[model samples]
Target chain A: MNLAKTALITLCLMGTTGLVHATDPNLARNLAATCANCHGTNGKSLGGIESLAGEPKQKLLQKLADYRSGEKPASVMHQIARGYTDEQLDLITTYFAAQK
Target chain B: MQNRRDFLKTAGIAAAGSSVFGIAGCAGMGKGSGGHVVVVGGGYGGATVAKYLRMWSEGQIRVTLIERNTAFVSCPVSNLVIGGLKTMADITMSYDNLKSRWGVTVITDEVRALDTAKRTLTTTNNGTITYDHVVLSPGIDFMTDSVGGLSGNEALVPHAWKAGPQTVILRTQLESMKDGGIFAIHIPKAPYRCPPGPYERACLVANYLRQAKPKSKVLVLDANGEIQSKKALFTKAFESYKGLIEYRPNNELRSVDAKTRTAELDFDKVKADVLNVIPPMRAGDIAARSGLPLINDRWVDVDWITYEAKGVPGVHVIGDALFPAPTMPKSGHMANQQGKVVAAAIINLLAGEAPNASPVVMNTCYSFVDGKNAMHVASVHQYDAIKKQPMPVAAAGGVSPAANEIEGKFAHAWAQNIWADMLA
Candidate 1:
C-alpha cells in the first residue's frame, strides 16, 4: 500500500476518536436498520445471519475494523466496512453494542 | 456463503448514549412530544417511519399510518412470484404488528385529500385526521401518458409493476402461453422505481420459460441506452440465458396495440404472445395533487437531512416520491433507510433539537437472475454538505463480483428479514 493509504489505515486501527460522531438517535437507527437486512431486525437474529444486539463496543469495533481490513473475509461486509469513515463505523458499532 | 459458527459474536443493535456525530443533542425541545404524526401509505418507507417514530420517541409521539390497502404486497421479490419461485402470500404482510407491537394506529382507508397547511387529511372510510406533522410516503404512480394508446390495452397488456393482482395476471399469461410463444417486457427509462428491477424481471421470466417451455423466448424493449444497474452481472445473465432472453436497448415505446399484442418502437414494430410494459414513473399522485413543490412537476423536493418538504413546514415525503439523491436508486432498501431518517428527524424536532446535518445512508438491492442464482448492487451515500446531496462514497460499496446461488439464498433471507423488520 502507498504511504498515504498505510497512514490512513493506521489511523483507523489506532482508534482515533471516531472520524465523525453521530449523536442523534435517528442517525444511529438509520445506520443500524441496514444491518437488519442480513443480521435480523433490531439486531436480533433468529438464525442464519448473526444477531448484533447488545454486543460490546470494543468487540464490535474490532470486528468492523477486521472487515474493513482484509483480516475478516466477507463479500458484503468488506464493502460495507469501507463505506463509512472510522467515526461512522465507530458510531454504528457503539450503537449495536449498546442495544439490549 | 460467508458462514459463521457464532451468531452472538457477529451482530445486533445498540440503543445507548453519548452523542458521536456533531449534530447530536436536543435543542428547542418539547414541542412535538405528545403531538400526533399521520403517515400516509404503508410500504417499506411508510411502515418503517411509523414504526421507528414510535420506537425512538418511546411513546412520546403518537403515530397513525393511513394506507389504502390493509396489507402490504412488497414489490422487491414480486418478480420471484411471477417466475413461480415464490407466491403472493409469501410476499404479502399485514399491519397487525405495527398496530399491536409498536402501538401505531393503523387505519385502513384511502386518503381523499391532504390539507398540509392545517395538518389534516380526509380518508374514504375514516373521518378526518388532524396532526401536528404529516409524512407522505405515497410511493410510485405510472406516467400512463408516457405511452399513448395504452388505454384499451389495459386488460391485454399488464404492467405487473406493483405487486398484487397484476402479478397474477402476468403469471397466468406466462403459464398459459403456447410452447413457442414470445413474452415481451418493456422497460421505461431511468428514475423509475427500482432501477435493476425490470432487468431482473426479464432474467427470472427467461429462466422460467427456459425450463417450463424450452421453445419459448423472452424479448426486452428497453428505453435506456444500455443495462442501467449491475451492468456486468446482468450482461452476464443475458449471455447465460441465451436463446431465451433477447435484449433490445433504445426501443422507446411510441405506442402499443394490445389486441394485436405489438408495440411500435422508434423505428420498428415488435410483437409478443404476452406483453408486460413497465411504464415510466413519477412521484405518487398525491405529492403533485397537494402541490408539494415538485422539481419538474413530478418528484417531491425535500431536505435530505430531515426529509421535510421544501417551503412546506411540518410535511415530509419519503419513498419513491422524493427525487433521488446523486447515484441513489429508488429501491426498497433505500426507502427503508429514508423512513428511519425521517422518523428520527421528526422525533428530534418534537424534542426541539436540530436535525443531524451529516447522515450516512446505504442500500443493498438483491436481484435474482433465476430461482437459484441472484446478484446484488450495494451503495453507501454520505450527506455532502457542500453539494447538499447524498453522494455515494467512493470504494465503500458496489455490485457483487458475480451472480451466485449463495447470494440467492441470502436474497430470500433478506426478504424475510426486512419483512419481519417492517411488519413483525
Candidate 2:
C-alpha cells in the first residue's frame, strides 16, 4: 500500500512537469506577436526602425522593463506597454534572443 | 530521441523561469542555441542589429522582436506618399517575411518598462522577460512646443513627421486646397531626421501642383540661411521647378494660429490655405527620462569605437538618438551600419572576445528631386579610438553619379535596393 502511494505521487509530479514545459513554446509565440508591428516579420524594422530578431534575450528584457518602469520614457511606447505582465516579457525575450 | 525530448523539456522550464523571475539558464549551452534575445523596436537600427546578430552568430542566437504597430510605415518614403506618387501601404511592411525567412520571433506589443539593473523587460500585455543584451531603435520625438501656439495641439496643426496618419492628414489637406491657394511648408534647424526630407516634400508637392493646380504655389520657410544635404542638387532642381514653388531662407517659424491657418515667421507672417509644420526634435522622451547622458537633447553618449556609453557600462546608443561626429547626417543607412557595428561589439563582449580596435562604417543619403531625377551622397568612415569618434575614410566614395544617365538610373535603383536591403 505504501509503495503504491509513493509511485502515484511521483507520477503526478512528472505529469505536471511535462505540462509546464509544453506550455512554454506557445506562450513565447503569443508574446512574440506583440512585437511584429514595427519590427519586421522576423524582427527587422523597415526604414528607420531597428531589428530585434537575434539580439541577446537578457539585454532585450532589461530594456523593455526599463521602459515600462519609467527608466525609459517614450511617450507613445509608455502608453502602449502598460498592459503586460511579468511572464509575457520573459517569453518574448527568450523567444527573440533564441532566433537564428 | 528521448534524450532530445528531455533536453527540450529542460530548456523550456529554464526559459520560463528566466522570463518570469529574471534568471539565466543553461539553455544557451545547447547545440547551436546561444541564448534568447529580445529587441524592443523594429526600426532601421533595430532591424539591422537583429539581422546581423543572427547572421554572424549562426544558430547560436534566437531573436525576438516586440513592437506596437502591425505594419512598419517608413518615414523615409512617407514623403513620397504625401507627394501622391506612393501610398502609405506601399511603404508598409509585415513581419511575415522576417519570421518565415529569418527564423526570428516577432511580438507585436508595446514595451512598457525595462529593468536594466535586473536585465528584465516587461510589455503592456506580454509580461516580463530577461535579456543578456537589449537594443533600442525607437526614433525621434518632435518638440511641438519649439514653436509657440503649436504646443500640445497636434490635432490643430499636424506635424506629419512620423509618416502615419499625420502624413495622410497633411496630404489630404493639400489635395483639397483651392486652386491658386498658398501651401506653406516649414523646415526646422539642423540635426533633424532625413535632412533632405522636407525639401523633397516641397519638390514633390510642387510637381503635383504643376499638373493638377497650376495656379497653386508652395512657399518654403527655412530656419537656416542655407539648406543642408545635397544643397547643389536641390538648388538646381528648385530652379527647374520654379514658379510652382518659392524658396525663403533664414526664415524661422515662431508661431502658428491653427484656427486661422496662419504662421508667424521670424521676418513675416504668412497666411496659408494649408500648413505642413515640421517641428524641432529631440531623442524620444524615454531616453531622457531614463537619465541617459545627453548632448543637449540627444541620448547615450558612447565611444565611437565600441559604441559603448561613455559613463554607463553595458549601455549603447545608435541612430538619431546618439551624437555622432558633425557632418554625419542622421539617415537610415547610417543607423543600419551603426547597428551592425554595435551588434558585433556586443557579440564579442558576450563571447569574452576582444572587439576590433577600429571599425569602419559606410553611409549613403539619397534624395528623389523629382520622379526622374535623384541625387545621393556616400562616404566611408574609420573610428579614432583615441579621440573616440569617427573620421571619414579617404576617397572610398563620393556624392551621386557624375553623369546624368547614371544619376537618374542609380536613383531609381538605389531606392529599390535600399528598400529591399531594409525590408527584404
Candidate 3:
C-alpha cells in the first residue's frame, strides 16, 4: 500500500482503541449515587462542601479513608464512608472520575 | 527547562524502542531501567513510594510491593470504624488499584529475610527476588516485652495499634465489658507510629462509651508527664464527657497481670476490665536482620538531605523505619511526603545526577478530640546538609488553633486534601 493510505489506516485503528478505553458510564453513575448525599449531584457541591467531580480517584479513596480514621474530621461524610466497602469505593471512584 | 527537555528526549527514545538510549538516560539520571524494586510492607510509605516511582517514571521501573494482605486497613481511620461512627468497609483499601492502575506487581506475602549484600529479598511465599533498589517501609514492630508480664501473650493484653484482627478483638472486648467497667489505655513514651493516635483513640472510645455504656470510664495511663501533642486541648474536651473519661499522666505501665486483669504502674497496681497496652516499638524485623545502621534505636539511617542511607550505598530508608528527627512523630502524612522525596532521590541517583540534596518535607497530624472538636499540627522542615539533620522551615505551616470554628473547618479540609494527595 501507498504511504498515505497506510498512515490513514493506522490512524483509524488508534481512534477505535482510544474509544474503547474511554471512561465507563455505568461506573460513573454508581459513583454519583454513592457520593450524591454529601458531594452533591455530579460531585459539584453546595457551599462548604468539596467537589469530587474530575478529582483523581486515588485521592478520593484516600480522603474517604482519612475521614473514617479521624485523621480527617468529617461532620457527615465520615458516617457516609463508614458504610462503603473497598469494592464499593473502587466503583464509586471509577464512576465519578468518568463524570463530566 | 533543559532537564525537562532532556527527560522528554530520553523518554521519547525509550518509548521508540531504543533500549540503549533508555538505559543510558536512566543511568544518566541515576535510575535503572529494568532492575526490580521490591518494597516490603505495603503501608503508607511503601505504597506511596511504589506508586510514585511507577507514575513519575512512566512504567520504566518494575516495582514489586510485598504486603501480607491484598487489602490495607488503615490505622489512621480505624478508630472511627470502632467508635461506630464509621464502618470497617470505609477504612479498607485494595492493592488491586496500585497493581492494575500503577503497573506495580503486588505480592501478597510476608517478607522473611533481606540479603542486602546479595540485593535479594525473600518472602514467605514468593521465595527470593533480587533488586537494583530496595525500599523498606515495614513500619513499627510492637515490643510487648517492654510491658513486662504482657510479653508473648498478646491475647490477654491486647494492643490494637496494628489495625487488623487485633483491632476487632479489642473492640469486642470493649463491647463485652460491663456498663460501668473501667477501660485502661496505656500510651508509650515517644517514637511511636502516629503520636496523636493514642489520644484520638481515647477520645473516640470515650465518645462511644458515653452513648453506649454511660457508666463506663476511660482512664488514660500516659508514660510521659503530659500528652505528647495538643495536650491542653484534648484535656479540655475530655471534661465535656465528665465521668466517662479521665486523663492520667506520668503513669508508666511497668507490668500487667492479664489473669487478674491488673496493671502495675509506676505509682500503683490498677485493676480494670479492659487493658489496652501500646508498648515501645522499633523498625520491622527485616531492617534489623539486614544489618542496616539505625539512629536513636530505630531503622536504617539516612541523611535527611538526600534520604540516602548514611553508611550503606544504594540503599535508602523512609517512613517510620528511619529516625529522621526526634520531634517529628511517625505519621502517614510525613511518610507520604518522605516517599516523594526519596523517589526523587532515586531517580536522580539513577541518572547520575545529584539528588535535590535539600528537599522540604511537610507533615500534618489531625486528632479528633471528640465527635466535633478536632485539633491539628502542620509543619514544614528542610534538611541541613552540614548539620546532617532536618530543621523546621520558617513560616511554612503551623498547628490548628486550640479551639475555634474556623480552625475546625480548616482541619477538616486539611484531612481531605492530604488524603487526596496520598491515595488519589
Candidate 4:
C-alpha cells in the first residue's frame, strides 16, 4: 500500500479528516481558551496587555522560549511557557501567528 | 479575528451543527473513533468540555452534559448585581449555543447517582445514560455546620455566593435597610470559590452604602488573617471608602441570630440590619455522593494531569469540587481552563495518544471596586508531575498596580468572551 493511503486510513480511523491539521483547532482552541481569560478572546487583548496574535511566528516562538528560560521578565508567561513542550509551543505560536 | 466559529468553519468540522442533528445525510454520527464523554453539572468546567470535545473531535465523539438548571448564572461578576451595579441577566447564560452550534446533548436534569461499575449515570429527568468518560464539575456547597444556626435558616441571612436568588435576596435586604443601618458581610477562609470575591463584595457594598445611604456603614468580617487575594488593591479600595467601611480579619463567625441580624464572632459580636454570610464551603453534594475518594472526605481527589478521580479510571473531577492546592484559586477562569485541560487529556486518550501531562492553567480574576472601577489579579499555574500539585512559576504572577476603570472594561469583555466560548 502507498504511504499516502496508509496515512489516510489511519487518519480516517482516528475520527478526523485530513482537512483538519494533526494538531486540530479543537486542541488549539481549547489550549488557547486559557489565554482568553487575560489576553482578551483568541489571543487578542483589549487593555494595555500586548496582543499575542498577529506577531511573527519566529518572534512569538522566540519570546515564548525566552519566557521558558529566565531571560524574560513576566508576571505569568514564564510559568505558562514552561507548561508546553517545544513542539507544542511551535503549534501554539503557529496557531496564534496565523490568527490575523 | 479568527473566532472559534471561524476556526470550525475553516476546518470544515461540523461548523453549523443545526443541519447535522435535525436533518440526516451527515458523516459518521455514532461514536466516532473516540468514545462518548458524559459531563455532569454544566457550569464553567462541564460546559467547556462538552463544547470543546465536539469541536476538537470534529463532531465525532459524542458529549452529553447533564445540568440541573436550564441556564448558567456565572458567579464571576455576580457581586456587581448584589450591589445593584449589574442585573442578573447581565451574568446569566443559556446552553442554547452549546447545543445548536456545538452539537452537544445538554440535558436539563440533576444527576442522582453515578454507577461507576456500569459506567452509567442515573439522573432525575433522564432515566440512565452510559458513557465512556464522565467529567464532574459540581462546584461548591456551603459547610453550614461550621457556623452555628445556619443550617435551616438560609433565607434569613443569604449567602449570595452561588450568584442567583441569594444574590437577589441580599440586594433586596440592602435596599430596604434604613439610613445609618449596618450592612455586614462575613467572609469565609481561603480555599473557597473566588478568593478575591468577599473583599470585592465588601468594596461594592461599601461603595453602595456610601453613595445611597451615606449614614449607613459596612462591616467586613473576614475569617482569614488578611485578604485572600489582591491585598494591596483591596486595602487601598477600603481606604477609599474610609469611615463607610470597617474591615476585621480573623473575626471568624461562630453563630448568627437571624432575627436580630447579629453575628457572634470569636473576638466580638456584630449587629447589622443586613447580613450576608458566606459560609465555609466544601465540594458540591454530588462529589461526596458519587463515591469518589475525596481528600478529607470533602473535595474530590484527582490526578492533576488528567483530572481523573484517583483510583477511578473513567471518572474525572474538576472545578471547585476538587480539593484546592496551595497555589490554585477556585475561580471560574481556572475551572474553565481545567475543563479544557481535562478535555485535552480525554481527547488525547480517545485518539489513542498519551495525555498531555504538563498542563498550564491561567487565572485572571477581575473584581469591580465599584460599578465602573475594577482591579485584577493574574497568575499562571503548571502541573508538577513530581509534587503532583499545580505550582506557580517564579515571578509569574502579579496584581494590578491599582484599581481603575480600564480593567473594568477588560472585565466586561472577559465575561462576554468567556460566556461565548462556553455557551455560544
Candidate 5:
C-alpha cells in the first residue's frame, strides 16, 4: 500500500478504537444489528442464509477479512465487509460471537 | 432524582434552542425506569425501530407504534403477485409478533398532528400520546396533481406502489386483459422509491405475458433517460422478452384519460387495455403536515447519523420520507438500516449519553428478472465524517454478472427475512 493509503487506514483504526471506548457502549451491538435484516436477529438466520450466532470470533473475523480482501467472493458480504473499519469489524464479530 | 416533569422540561428547553441534536441530563428514573417512544407508520422503517427500541431497552422504554394498516403488507415481493406468480398472502404478514413478542404496543390509527415542542402526537382515532421522542416513517405519497386528469382516477390507472389493495387491483386488471391486449406501465422520474422496482415490474409482467398471452405487448414508458438501477442487467433482461417488451425513454406522463385508458405524453398519446401509471411522489402526508423541514418540498431533511429531522427536535424521520444522501436509494433495506441507527441514537439520547460517533448502513436489493431468475445490486455506505453523510465505499458494491436461479431463491428468502426483521 502507498504511504498515504496506509496512513489513512491507520488513522481510521485509531479513530474507531477511541470512539468505541469513549462514546457508546452499545456500539458493537448496534453495528451488528444492521445485519439482522438479511442475516436474522442476532445473526441466528431464519433460513436460506448463513447464521452468524455462536460462531467463534476469530472465525467470523477471518471470514469478514477475506471478504474485505476479495479473497472469499460473496454475493453481498464482500461489498458490505469493505464498508467497515477493521476495529468496527472486530467489535461486530465479537458481539455476534457472544450471541446464542 | 429527575422525574417525568424534569425530563419533559429538558427536552422542551433543548428543542427550543438553535440546535436540538443533543438533549441534556437523564430523566432520573429509578433503577427500573425508562421513557416512552412513539413511532408513526408501522412500515419497514417504523416497525424495525420500534422493535429494536423495545429489545435494546429491555422493556424499560415503552414503545407505541401508530399505523393506519392493521397488518404489514410488503412491497418487495408484491411484483411477483402482480405477475401472477405469488399471492397476496405471500406478500402479507401479521404485526402480531411485534406486539406479542417484541412488546410493542401496536395502535391501528393514523397520526393527525404532531406537537414537537410538547413532544405529543394526536391520532385520528385514538387520543393524544406523549412521548420522549417520536419517529415518523410514513413512506412516500403520490403527487397525483402533477399528472392532469389523474388525481382521482387511481382506480382506473392503478400505481400499485404501496403493495396492498392497489396491488390486487392491478393484478385483477392484468388477469382480465385480453390475450392480445397491451399492458403499459409508466415510470416517474429518478429518486423514486426502490430505484429498480419499476423495471422489475415490467420484467415480471412481460414474463407472465410471454407465457399466458404471447400476442400481448408490454410498454415501459419511462420518464427518465435510461434505467435508474442495474441498467445493464435490466437491459439484458428486456432482451430476453424480445418483441414482447418495448422501452421508451423520456416519455413522461403529462396527463391521462382515465375513461379511454390513454396516456398523454409531450409528443404522442397511447392507449392501452390496462394503464398503470406510477405518479410522481413526495414524503407521506403526515411528514409534510408535521412542520418538518423538507428538501425540494418533497422529502424530509434529516441528520445522517441520528435520522433526526433537521429543525425538529426529538423527531426522527426515516424510510422514503427522508431526502436520501448521495447514491443512497430509497429502499426498504436502507430504511431498515436507518431504523437501526435511529434506534441506537434514541436509546443513547434518552439516557443522556452521546450517540455512536461512527455508524454503518448498507443496502442489498434483489430483483427478479423472470419467475425463476433474478439479479442483485448491492452497495455499502459508511458515515463520512468529513462530508457529514454516508458516502458509498469506493471499489466496493456492484451488480450481479448475470441473472440466475440462485439469486431467485435468494430474492424470496430476502423478502421473508426482511419482513420478519421488521415485524417479527
Candidate 6:
C-alpha cells in the first residue's frame, strides 16, 4: 500500500528471480579486475606504476575524469580513461577504493 | 572484499517482507565451487585463466594447465632479444610460481586432441584428463608452408616468431654476418600474432647492426601494404635508421633459397647474409584439429561474453585464437584481459549465476624502436549489446605523441607488472 513497501516488493521480486536490481553486485569487482594487469592485483602495484588500492574513491574518480576530459596529462591513462562510461568508472573506482 | 555471506545477507534483507520470495544461493557462491578446469598452452591467456580460476575461486576449483614449454617466455619483448638488446634469459620466466603459489597443476606437455563431447583432452605425455570446462589458449602456430622452403629449413632462415630457440638463432645469424652484409626479414600478412612485432623486430635489428656492424644493412620485406600498427611512429623511427634500414611494402614472399639465404619475391630476388622470415600464422595445432568453428579458417569464433566457442558446450577459447571483434589486436595484454573475463565467467557459471553482461577489455601494446625509447598504442573495448561483441570505444585510446624515454620506462614497468600479474 505504501511506496516504501512497493519498492521493497519490487526489489524482492528482482532478487528472487535472479535479476540484477540497480546494478550487478559483482560488476564493480569485475571491472576493477581489468586494472590489475597494469596496476597490480587488487591495485597494489609492484613497480613504478601507481597503486590504486585503498585510494579515496572520489580522488580516483576525479583523476579518471580529468584523464577523460584531457585536463590531465598522462602518457597512457588519458587514452585509457575515455573508454568507460561514467557509471562504469564510478563502480571501478569504488571497487578499487574498497580494496585494502 | 564482499564475500558470499555478505551477498546473501543483503539478499536476505531485501526479501524479508515476503516469505514467498526466497533467494536461492548460488552453488558457485563461497570458496571451492568444486570443478576441475584444464587449460591448454600456458601462455598469457592460459596462465592468467589458470591462476585466476584458483585464486577467485579460493582454491576450490581445480586447475590443471598443460603447456608445451617448461618455462614461460614472453613474446611481447622477444623483439629486443632478436635485436641483441636483451638476452633469452631476460625474457624467459618460470611456471613454478603458478604451480607453487597458486596451487595450479602445471604440466609441461602438449595437447594433442580435444574430445568436446566428453569434455576431456588428450595430451602428449600427461594422458587424457576430464574437465568441467576446458580452456584452449594455444597461441598462433605459423603457416610455415605459406613461405616456400620455410618448413624444414628453419635452421637456415629462422622466423624467431615464437621467442625461444629461433630467437637465439636469428640473433646468432645476425651476429655471424660480416660487415656490409644484408640482414633481411620477411613479415607475413596482418592478423598474425602481435601486429606491431615485425616492425619492432626491424627497429631492434637495425639498432643492433648500427652499433655492432655499421656497414651491414637491414631489409624488411613486408606482405602488407602499410605498417600494421603504430604506423606514423614506426615510420618516423624508420627514418632514424635512414640508409641502414630499407622497408619494402606489398612485397609478399613468393619463396626463398635456403641454401644461399636468398628471398624470391614477386618482383625482386633479395640476397641476404641472414634471412629471418616470419610466416603467417593461424590458431595453434590443437585448436585447428578440435573441430571448433573458425573464422576465415583461421581464428575460432566465440561468444565474447563467455569466451565460449559457439555451439560448443563446456569449451571456452580465448586470446589470439578467437576471431577478434573489430580492431581487437591479438596482443598479450588483450589475452590477459580475456583470461580474467573467462575466469570470472566460469566462476559464475559454476555457481549457477549469470556472467557479467557489461564486460570490458583494453589493450596497451608498447614497441621499442630502439634500446631506450618506446611508443605505445592503447584502446579499450566494451561489450556492445546490439553487436553482441566487444567494440572499441571511439575517442578513447590512441598512440603516443612520440616515442620517449619515459614511455620506455613504463614499457619496462608494464612487462614487470604484467609478468607478475600472470605468473607471480
DockQ of each: 0.21, 0.02, 0.03, 0.21, 0.23, 0.43
In Å, residue B270's CA in model 3 sits off its true spot by: 0.8
lDDT of 6 by residue, B1-29 (tens): 33444544554454555454332222214
By the TM-score metric, which is better: model 2 or model 6?
6
Candidate 4 C-alpha lDDT tens digits along B1-424: 2333333232234323334321121122212355789999888888988987887677877899998888999998888888889899998888998899899998999988999999999988789999989999999999998899888888999999997888889999999999999989999877788889998998888878888999999999999999888898899999999998899999999999988889999989988899899999889998888789888878889888789988998899999998876678898888888998887777766654446656778777889899888877777786677898888765566677788787788788778767766777
Can you list the residue pairs that collide in candidate 5?
none
Off by over 4 Å in 3: A1-100, B1-34, B403-424
- Which of candidates 1 and 6 is the stronger one according to TM-score? 6
lDDT of 3 at B367: 75
For this target, which candidate reaches the highest TM-score against the unseen true structure? 6
TM-score of chain B of each: 0.92, 0.87, 0.89, 0.91, 0.93, 0.94
Q: Would you list the rank order by DockQ, best first?
A: 6, 5, 1, 4, 3, 2
Score each candidate by Cα lDDT. Answer: 0.80, 0.67, 0.69, 0.78, 0.85, 0.86
Docking quality band of candidate 3, CAPRI definitions: incorrect
For B1-424, candidate 5 gives per-residue lDDT tens digits of: 2454454444444434523122111122111237888999888899999998988878788899998998888899889999999999988888899999989999999888999999999888899999988999999999999999998999999999998999999999999999999999999997799999999999999999999999999999999999999999999999999999999999999999999999999788999999999999999998889889999999999988788899777999999998998889999999899999988888766755456667788899999999999988988888888999999988778888999988898887777787888887
Compare candidates 1 and 6 on lDDT and give the better one.
6
Ordering by TM-score: 6, 5, 1, 4, 3, 2
Per-residue alpha-carbon lDDT of candidate 1 for residues A1-100, written as tens digits (9 for 90 to 100): 3453344333322221223343333456567766776677779876656789999989988888898886997767788888888866676777788889
- Models ranked on lDDT: 6, 5, 1, 4, 3, 2
On residues A1-100, what C-alpha lDDT tens digit does candidate 2 reach at each position?
2453344333323332323432322335434533443444446555344567889988887887776676884422333344444665677678788776
**lDDT of candidate 3 over B8-124, digit per residue (tens):** 455444434535422333323333444467777777788877877776566777888888877887787777766767666766767776877888898889878877788888788
User: Who is ahead in DockQ, 5 or 6?
Assistant: 6
| Separate clash counts for every candidate | 23, 99, 16, 1, 0, 2
**What DockQ results for candidate 2?**
0.02
Give the C-alpha miss distance for residue B372 in model 5, angstroms.
Answer: 1.1
